[model samples]
Target: MLWTLRSPSVRHLQPCLARKLSFTPNSRLPRITKDAVREIPPSTSFREQVARSAAPKSFTSEIKTPPVRNQVIVFLVGSFAVYSIAAEQCNVETAKWTKKLSGSSLIWKVREPTSEELRKAKRLELGRKLQAGLSSLKDMTEGWSQTMRGLAVWSYIQVFQPILDAGDGKRTCWAIGGVNTLVWAAWQVPKFQPFMMKHFAHNPLSGISYTLLTSMFSHRSFLHLLFNCMALASFGKSSGVAASVHLMKEQAKNPHGIQETDVTWHFLAFYMSAGLFSGMTSHVMTSKVLYPRMIARLTSKAKPVDAAAVAKTSETITETSEKTILPSLGASGAIYAAVTLTALAFPHTEIALMIPPSFPIPIQWGVGGIVALDVIGALRGWRFFDHWAHLGGAAFGAWYYNYGPHMWNSVRATHLEASQKVQRPEKTD
Candidate 1:
């Protein structure tokens, strides 16, 4: 009879009754009323009845209050997240990639430094100097003054003067000016020479290796810097270096305009990569072939020994001379690369020579003549400059001019596809 009760108020008691009794209603149990249900003990063993008693008396009357502990936890978490992001300002992702790809600790992974990092580095340097010895406060101040002067002059000459005087707001001039400033600084500072030689020059014999890219900005000879700067000023602009005719045509035909900044970034990547490729070529030749041959020739001449004996003697000489560091540093390699690319892009364009018989010649003809001279010089072992480097640079320019664009596009497409796949949800069975 209780099971057949139709009162909606008694529905809450159904679960408690089900737990207390079997499938059949018990005859001994008292009938349930709203008042009787309300009178149920708060500490009841029956779960439903305990839950009903524990529930809020009124949903609207309950104050909206958040836990202080929860608020404190969320604030701490948010602050930590912000701190982590800020701390990663100098993220070394590119450096890590370079190190991983090269598989060499000899070559330093280089990146452009920010102002904060530069200041910190200077502080460290000054602190170390202070710890070494204290000559005089006056002397320290003077030294610091000189350093500041040099830095100010360099920055003014490179980044500011060009922008102010050129009257043209182009990214290329700023880049060129900055490089020129570095070249000038490298030449002027005696300390810089040893630093560059040890760390920046790509010498297989040297323990330090970042010189592959740094060498592109190095030029000890004033004439060399002048020549490279002239060539760069002529062709380093966006109009000349940023895009090929084919790229320009595509941009023109497309509805959306391509960003010039992207092109500039791509050109920078090409230039740095070209320098590394050129350096690698020279390193292989000097370390593996040229150095050994020189040793062999000297060994043979010294004793007039048998060929096998001479070879053995040369090996001995090489072992003894292993400590000798051989390094080639200059921007000629990268400069030649730019020249080759420019010539290939506009074969009909005329280039003027700085030396005698100075006349404008077709770019293709000029580049060919220069390349031929380099090839001859390399074979003959001319030590005036790195002819092998020139050849390597030329080869890189040609290769990049042909396949670089396609490769870059393909890489970007593949990356975009991968990202899309990751973002898309999986299908259900």
Candidate 2:
């Protein structure tokens, strides 16, 4: 009988009997079946393949961990929920019952109209009416624009209420000039105010060149005057006077005497020149050859039908318009001058503006930027605004700030020399 060893193989040397021995048919030893010992092909079924490829696992088993990806997603979702809830709550509280949020669409709180609120609202409305009526009356008295003057006065009050009852001389001049301009030349007034525009006007021969000091009062609207006055009060009042005084005191101890009145004169010049410069810049641009093209186009009635022709025409018109057709209106030039002077004189002071509401630009940046932009606009032949006036006003302000002290000292010296000569102790001449 043939037997297969299931244990480790051992080398056995049986007595060297016959090489091949056969067991008796009735031997008790168990026989190994060929089927059980036969090799079987690798189990290629899905289950068996998967089992073979799998790594050996310990019986202790593995403990699963929290997924990192899942943790991040959960955190983001939670944060979003908090933000959404906060926004909703704020919106709910801010919602207006009356349904008016100025000129915008945002919801604002509707406060129950209290008696005091009603009274205040009524007073404000009445005050505006009274101001209007008073301005008209004042206009009659002044023989110029009394209404615009009132607005300028109000603006000054608003801006300089913080300083004192008496604020600045330049601001006062600006207010006066604005009133004069509104009544005298009415081309720059906004729609909300009167629009009696200035017509073609000049003396018969050698007409006013606008270089005249009186030309400062030439704005089109009362509002223009108001804005300039406000700027002057806010900026000029704080700095111009203080700087003039400081400079005057400093020069008092010097060999060459200085005059406070001489230094203070530029305050008047700044107010007057800024307005005149802006108007002159606009006038010059308007009078340019190409400006007539823009005016003609703007005033024309019929539209061109040809696409190619229209395109070419539009390009020409744009080029021509940019080359001319600019009118510099408004008191922004003057206001910017005041702002520049104020910034140069008081480098660290903060300024507030009420023009756009809720936001204030820095004085230095605001003044310098306007001047620079005007210069660029003028150089580029832009047709949108009067950049020349802006540059002129700002330049005047800078020059005045730097040289005012010296000029004042020179004037004082001249005055001293004249007075001493006049008061000379002369004997027999």
lDDT of 2 by residue, 243-320 (tens): 333443444444552212222343443455445544444444444433444445543653645778756766765565
Per TM-score, the best of the predicted structures is 1
Distance from true location, Cα of 146 in model 2, Å: 31
lDDT of 1 by residue, 44-134 (tens): 5787677678654432123122123322333345333433332232123323333343453333335434223332343454456643443
TM-score result, candidate 1: 0.53
After aligning candidate 1 to the native by TM-score, how far in Å is the CA of 295 from where it should be?
A: 1.2
In candidate 2, residue 15 scores what lDDT? Answer: 44
Worst 10 residues of 1 by lDDT: 254-263
Residue 90 of model 2, lDDT score: 23
Model 2 scores what on Cα lDDT? 0.48
What's the lDDT for all of these models?
0.57, 0.48
